[model samples]
Target chain A: MSEPILDRPRPVAARRDAALPEPQAQDPDLELVDRWRDGDESAFASLVRRHHGRTFGLLVRMLGSREEAEDALQETFLNLHRHGHRFRREARFGTFVYRVAMNAALNRRRSLGRRRAQLERLASRQAAGDDLPQSPRGPEAGVVQGELRARVQREIQALSPNLRGPLVLYDLEGLPYGEIARVLELPEGTVKSRIHRARRALRERLIDLVSESDDESEGAGQ
Target chain B: MSLRLGHRRFRDQLSDYADGQLSPRLATRFERHLASCADCRKELGELRRMLELLHDLPAAEPGPGSVDALLRRMAETEARPRRWLSAWGAPVAAAAAGLAALLLVQDVSVSIGLPGSAVRPEARSASLVAAEARALPRRPAPPAPSTAAMLGRRAEFAPATPGAPSGASSSGRSALAACIGSRDTRDCIRYHWMLDLAGRDVPAFLEVFESLPEAARPRLAGDLADLARGSGSATAIADHLRASRDPRAATLAARFAAVGRR
Candidate 1:
């Protein structure tokens, strides 16, 4: 994976302004959006550079697969190009981009689910054996931590998209409840309840996974 | 009034409290409840731990070629408009086929008349001529056309005289007088009738426009040459028709263009 320019210890702030330019950015995103609408191709490239990484991260969290996320990311930018004229100046550009990214990721996941059986059949035909490739990090780097991460990922993926979307946007992306509500087209109360419920559900599963991993570690040591 | 703050209630508050999202009153109440509840305290601690774990989830990074591939795809999409044909192609073709079937089934009458020549020679009044020469966009768009609508019911020039009730006839006559006082009654009445017809039925307006005497077309299409300023679907159709350079059609197009309705 390419290095993310916005990655820092203070990711919340970084994510918020991830679309801004690196040095002396003269124009805001709205200005760039206008220029892009007027057929300024470079303005669009500037927008892509500004938002693609953050958009890519959002797709990965929502879709939970790099290959699918990449496809969704492309679709998201293409849609932005096509429909940028519909952007209302009254709204935040970041919010608009987030809505587009979330929609593209969720839609791709929905279609991907329908195509899974067909994909599996194609995969089996190309596979040399049923055994999968090993992780490059190997099993030495804290087996319990690996299992915990894997289990957490599996549980998150298993979450209904409605609940999972709010959780990812609020917890992982640090978007406020109101913003999540707008992006998800839910009431603020619904977003808040979903976040709370999602946290409780995730905590329960993580707690169970931790206990199970502890028991296994103890058994192995004996 | 005081409300119950039981284990269930406290559990719900724990996540909001961790996020510092609770109102001051609710926070104070929850804190007061937490001061005595050990079970609630333990649950809050677990919830905070989970939040921390979630916050620490690694940010996803895109592969180096991701942006390049996206740009390439966008370029290809820009180069190939044919790809978009699939979006509306089937529906449009089906609608076209259905329209063709309808047209084939119906033996419609084709009228050939001079452009803006709807005025009956005997009924040509000075007030109607005066009303027709007024600038474009005199009134807002009429209601949308429906198949069962009485087309051109308002075509009769009802001159509004003093002491008469402000009915359709009065307004129609008043509109005619407004156009006639500014220009020739012949041109004004023709232009006014054409505008009304365009609003009522585009196909009928186009038929008359196409059949108009070439010599009288330009003189009749006053202010209608610039009818591209209207709103909604009517303006869109007007814009396409105005491109035909038919002077009478342009006059009709201007009428639809003046009204900002669908």
Candidate 2:
């Protein structure tokens, strides 16, 4: 069994605002959307720059590849540009755009037939400890953290898109379940169950990894 | 600490507990369970670490020119207009092909060479006229029955006497509308033919029906079915013709009755 890691629970509301910077005091995202609707091209560029990082990040994790995420990013923006006039003022613009990006990313992932292949590749990479993001030389603890990051990513990649999409949106992005329901177009109850299933799947994967390592060390000691 | 929580409930609360999302009452119960359960505690710790690793993964950056390329594509798309040729090109092509077929059927007025090819030249011409009527946008007014019989043609193609509804012109638009509304290829052509044939004189169609041989009865039955299927007046015409003693009329009326029930 793994030992408890002494980690404090962060405030969900604070984390939400930190991850997604609110439309600032003077310059709101809606103002940019209105300008774009009025044919201001520069307003569109500003919107893209403001939202692209998180949108691109979401797509990357959803697609499990950089190239496909890039393609989907273009599609999401193009759709927004074309249909900007139809944007309803009642809902939050950020939620609307995230919904668009999630739909486009999920569609692109399904079209490529890479869901299974991607999971298999991530699993093998996790086994080899090659799933970590590249980093310069650091302390021994950083190496361990990188490996742990790699293992988590592999398990996340292994999850089906339905489970993975909600998990990433909630756990990684720190969006509320209500916001997640808007993004995924799912009921709040469904989103909750999916997140719970996703965490369970990830924990099970970790437990399996731990057991295998324990067996390996015991064999080596004998 | 009084009630021991089951493993199923422990697993369900683990995700919410890690994120501090569980309600305060539920959280208290979960904490009570955690004190006594080492297994649940280890799993909760693992869930926390998993959440941390997910959050720690670096956000991906969009490559340069991503926006510029999409904007350029959008501009290209806006510059193009949606056109009728792009939208209805396939159907227009099909209509043209149908028109060409009607012309070909008209050209081949002679008796076709087939085994037991005993069909009269006039009957063959009548069938071609039927196909042509289906191909045309509007059915032409018919000649008088006396004139048609004198010309050696079927009497059903005769012009209407005064005071009748003039089924040919009256029902032409409705049948054409049906043709447009229906997706079935065979039904569209059949409805078009029936409307054109009876559109001139309803009884004239029965007169023509009575004269056709056994081999042509099945098609006549199907046409009657199509006509009766669409309009109440056509159903009435079929019922009116049902009392006829002629075998062909009986077959056509039976088909009309069968279709009307449906």
Candidate 3:
């Protein structure tokens, strides 16, 4: 198995802005939502800044394509704008917003069936020729990094929509099972099971990639 | 083996256990089982590794200009003038005047009489008549009854007169009938009554509509569209219509463009 890439330590100093004390008062998101409802247009922009990255990340992982993810993200925000009043603050604003984004992504996937099929076929064809025999990771890990990224992307694309949604939300997005259930409107048990199953399936698919480097090292020594 | 220690049961709870969602008692039992179970241990390890890979995938940001476009759309909608039916039209003017006269006469009759006697018979009669009219099955106009039959019925109650007041105008009845002719009308009426009867029970209405049989869905969709048009709120209706597969309902919903356009 290829050595798992250690996550680069994110700069702690950069997190200072994020760690700054949140207002000791009301929930900022609830306030922003209220402002938007009251027709203060700028309040929505604040919401976008706060959530856009996470929302975009979930979309990308769900779609497995940057362009489509971008489109879905835009639609999600637009939908939020058009239907802001429908939000009742029944749950955390994050959960409510993620649910909306996830639904939008799923709907967009259904609508893009023909295009997606064509793209998948193209992707598979590209994968066949481009599957360079696993390269050894050394001082220059660029090739290994690129190959691993591509493999990850392909495996994500291969997952069924049902499995993919929970996997992306729980695994890629690191959302808790309860929050995922809220977003997907499924029972918490169902969300957890799907995430587990999705993870198992992805590991089985990628085990060869992980093991290839070890096999190569053994052969070289022999 | 304990009843809960079977493989099928374990598999069902495995996801929950992995997610740390299992109740403490069950989790403790499961943890004990996992300590001895090699297969479960390996499975969990593999699953965790996959999750790590998934977590490493980069986040994708939305393309530029999309937010601006959305904002512009919102602005345009906000800036659009609200459309309302003009009250200056002759029919509306006449109707308003008649209603005023009816109310005035009712007030005067109530004021002139003593105590309970002040209750105007006409007003009570009008209400009873309106209730009866509303209760009648919404159907196309039936042929007029023979003069003899009318006279017989009238004689049973009050003396027959050549110019007895009609229960309701034929035109108004026909207009209402036409409105209720389709399944759409029935669904709209059902929703209207549900909403009115409970006051903005939107979730209940949605639940009812969602549970409707496939065969009835198109009609309900049409009814929703009609109601949206009538009420001058088309966004929800349009969203429903867009999600529906029935082309006919979609076409019917398209007619509600005027509601959202303004």
Q: Which candidate is the best by lDDT?
A: 2
DockQ of 1: 0.15
Clashes of each: 20, 4, 3
The stretch of ten residues in a row with the least summed lDDT in candidate 3 chain A is: A1-10
For model 2, what is the error of residue B69's alpha carbon versus the real structure, in angstroms, after optimal superposition? 4.6
A6-80 per-residue lDDT for model 3 (tens digits):
221233222432532222324558887776555444666668767877787788878777778777877787677
lDDT of 3 by residue, B177-217 (tens): 34445434322223333222111223323433444456765
Clashing pairs in 3: A1-A210, A1-A211, A2-A210
Candidate 2 lDDT by residue in tens digits, B198-255: 4343454555444446576577567556654665445544555464444555656566
Tens digits of per-residue lDDT, candidate 1, A185-210, equal 78989998998888878777555322
lDDT (10s digit) by residue, model 1, range B182-227:
6554343344444444444456556545444566555445343322
Per-residue lDDT value at A200 in model 3 = 66
TM-score of 2: 0.51
CA lDDT of each candidate?
0.53, 0.56, 0.51
Error of 3 at B207 (Å): 50
> Which residue runs does candidate 3 get wrong by more than 4 Å?
A1-26, A125-143, A210-222, B1-45, B61-262
